[model samples]
Target: MPHAYQPPQRRSRLTRRGRLLLLFTALLGLGLGATVLLPLLSPGEAPEKPRQLLIPEGWRAAQVYAAIDKE
Candidate 1:
């Protein structure tokens, strides 16, 4: 009697768990890279402007000093 021939098996395929782990690792790496690079790529914040006080015209020196101190 003649025996049937069997083909050689391949071993490079990943299991379901392995594929999920690989996907999770890739996503984690991408998130980490973005977290590290986003700050460096973004423009700096604008500087704050100095506070200003508008005093009425003809104000006395003492009044002006008081207004400045009050603010």
Candidate 2:
């Protein structure tokens, strides 16, 4: 009987742990991307402009505090 020549079989590079790690990394990336993009994509209220206070010159500190409190 003559022996037959057979080619060696190749194995996968990623093991079970590697596959799980890759999946976890992909999921984490997707979660981070969604977190960053969701606020930008959704329709939301525009930010209100800051209110400016016009204080006359020579106003006392107490007057300024009272005006701020009133507003």
Candidate 3:
């Protein structure tokens, strides 16, 4: 003997408005995630700006590097 087959039941799903709300939430999450992660992933070099520093005439390049590294 064989048993009769039955159709599968439909799943409860979000309505049209609920679908749109979910999409909006997903996009917001993606944008915020990118904003926080992008910086740490690629820290672009600091812009090179021309600035003058006044120092004793005798201060050599090595001394300047040492002084800056110490601070």
Candidate 4:
């Protein structure tokens, strides 16, 4: 008698635990890449200082125009 042939069982889809583990691994990889790679890629220029402007609180449009005209 010939032995009966049987098909292999299909693999199951990822479970909740497997999905969470994949997500954690992806985030850890991205974090490591940023920490190790960013400084090496950045140029050595000193960071530009931001310009400061002082606008008085509650100043109306007319007041701003008058101030500009006085200059």
Relative to the true structure, how large is the alpha-carbon lDDT of every model? 0.95, 0.95, 0.88, 0.88
Candidate 1 C-alpha error for residue 54, in Å: 29
Model 2, which residues run further than 4 Å from truth? 1-11
Q: TM-score for all predictions?
A: 0.49, 0.78, 0.48, 0.49
Considering lDDT, which of the candidate structures 1 and 3 is the better prediction for this target?
1
Q: What residue runs in model 3 are displaced by over 4 Å at the alpha carbon?
A: 1-9, 46-71
Clashes in each model (backbone N, CA, C under 3 Å)? 0, 0, 0, 0
Candidate 2 residue lDDT tens string, 1-71: 59888788897699899999999999999999999999999999989999989889999999999999988
Q: How would you encode candidate 4's per-residue C-alpha lDDT over 1-71 as one tens digit per residue? A: 59888899898899999999999999999999999899989887898898655669999989988877775
- Candidate 3 lDDT tens digits, 1-71: 49788899899999999999999999999999999999989969998888665667899999988877765
Model 1 regions more than 4 Å off: 1-11, 46-71
Segments in model 4 whose C-alpha atoms lie over 4 Å from true places = 1-3, 45-71
Candidate 3: the clashing residue pairs are: none
Best of the candidates, TM-score: 2
Cα deviation of 60, candidate 1, in Å: 34
RMSD of each: 10.8, 5.2, 8.1, 11.6
